[model samples]
Target: MTESFPTVPLDGAPGMPLIGFGTWLMSGSECYEAVRTALDAGYRHLDTAAIYRNEPEVGRALRDSGVDRDEVFVTTKLPPPRADQADQVLAGSLDALGVDAVDLWLVHWPPGGARPDVWERFVAAREAGRARAIGVSNYSLEQVDELTGATGVTPQVNQVSWAPPLYDPAVEAGHRDRGVVLEGYSPFKNTDLGDPVLREVADAHGVTPAQVVLRWHVEHGVVVIPKSATPERIRANLAIDGFSLSDDEVARIDGLAEV
Candidate 1:
């Protein structure tokens, strides 16, 4: 929507930025500062989870950034333990994040394997206008099917740990068939950035291998959230929009799955 970065259309239909800032281990002032740095670097999407216990810091940075709430896409997840009190947990997240409604809300994991009971509350929250869109994380396509079958409501997105080495065409196709947007976390953690293929492609694009990896995710239209506490890497990671990858290059990267 900002036109600064590409976005994938969400389920009920809204543009979610292809790149988002991930907050996993960051906390306190470090979380605050990194989030501030990310916002200053033109990141319009922010991902945080209740389990991270840093939603308040993330919220603080967003407010301090002076960016209008509507201009940013915010996501928070419900931890498994809080599944029974889903509504209260969402309320607490809202209070911590200082927002009335989050752009997206997710079930952190399977929560006892596709617990539709938790999903039913998510559906109610959406209807109550507490969240704009809802989805799941670390869910198999079958689990997604189970939720949908139980409630007739399919998750809009599925967030998982992904990178080139883990690429599976069938898994990608499965989400497409289900009309679910795929979001990938731990992009660098799961990648071999030093691999020659990545090095060669990075050289071709005049970027770092990490940049090439991030661009690869965007190339496949998969949402990637690369996190960093360092100022330079934070900005460098968001600098991938300047170049486009060749078809051959993408094929080579995809082939990394076999190697």
Candidate 2:
């Protein structure tokens, strides 16, 4: 059975679903089905990007799910190459997704355009009501500061690669001090779920290792989007609300970092 998912508040809009379903490599009918399955499994947040080239499929799934558009929180990204044409790029995404406005729009990566210039365009999108909230992905602390310092507009969220193996308290503190919500992607890429420590925690909670790791992110207040096309994993990923990780357990995973 699917579990009830919760939400985390953003700076300028309604709260975002804490656990989002990610569609990175998925496309065509597979992407549509994955999204449909995710929504049916109780996932209210869906994350996609222009680079994925799956917006239309995702939009179709959303329409077929019988779920009200307002009930689901959708996030799509702006690639760096389109930074100069931010307005057109976002419009194209909206058209592809068949949505009037996305709940949150993000800059997919940092290398395409000048950080300040790109961020300014993103801010313009929010101002134009094309996106309810705007943020950045794959940005470092310095770049995040540069955007705010230059444009006087801070990004509401920073989506980056974060996992037990690469978690850094200092960098995370920087995000918190800047009032940026740390939304983590590729959460399962950096760690070995089969590690005895993680397995032991999973055993204790009678859940999977992935659930243990996701719960750890929850306890730290980080938004996690775990991608999976399988229905069983989709349901399992959102079933994290029923358990709580001990402070000691969280510290153990924190201390297990290789970097």
Candidate 3:
């Protein structure tokens, strides 16, 4: 079955596939097969991290899948603790992924309570063609301003754990003003799949609660990376293009957020 995947405007960077396959807490052969399956299922964007310790497996799958390198958007992160080794870490990541450069590279987190310096190194990597676009994950507004102030190169993306209860409109708007796309991790909140509001929306649409949450991310204009190892779930996750929620339904899901 051909799936119509959505594309999101990624600031100055190339357009990002709206739904990316996230590889967190998945490793070894399991990671390899899952990635292969996702690609075969038409997932063009893949999200991984240096901390995940499975880039090699993910890389193997990519190579074995025979998909052209440029056709797939591969993203990886650098552990915050390796702030000083940003350049070296990026090289290692490239080696593991068996690629000369990654589509996107991120500083996994704010490091040493100071992110500007780490961000500067990321800027260097971008200049050296180690990564096509550089960004941060789990960063606050202050950190975003600090990095832009120091490097004058605003991040192309800022990934964070954004769901109903934890969604921060101010942060989202701040990044948008700076031309940084918000990539939401853990859109399902790792639980709450059975929440009454989400269940109602899912039943109304005749889809799964997971699809409702992912659609929420898409409507909010945030990029999303939902991880799954099951082939059926992977296919189900990508099946969100046929339906949309009404304004009332969206407000209902937004209202489910706890203050």
Per-residue CA lDDT of candidate 1, range 1-259, in tens?
4756898887553589999999999999999999999989999999999999999999999999998887889999999877999999999999999999998999999888899999999999999999999999999999999999999999999999889999998999999999999999999998888999999999987899999999999999999999999999999999998998988999999999954
Candidate 1 regions off by >4 Å? 11-13
lDDT values for all models: 0.93, 0.88, 0.85
Cα-lDDT of candidate 3: 0.85
Q: What is the lDDT of candidate 2?
A: 0.88
Clash counts for all predictions = 0, 0, 0
Each candidate structure's TM-score, on Cα atoms with residue i matched to residue i, is 0.98, 0.96, 0.95
Which tens-of-lDDT digit does each residue in 127-168 have in candidate 2? 888898999999888888888889999989999998998889
For model 1, what is the C-alpha lDDT against the true structure? 0.93
Candidate 2 wrongly placed segments (more than 4 Å): 1-4, 112-114
> What clash pairs does model 2 have?
none
Q: In candidate 2, where is summed lDDT lowest over 10 consecutive residues?
A: 1-10
Higher-scoring candidate on lDDT, 2 or 3: 2
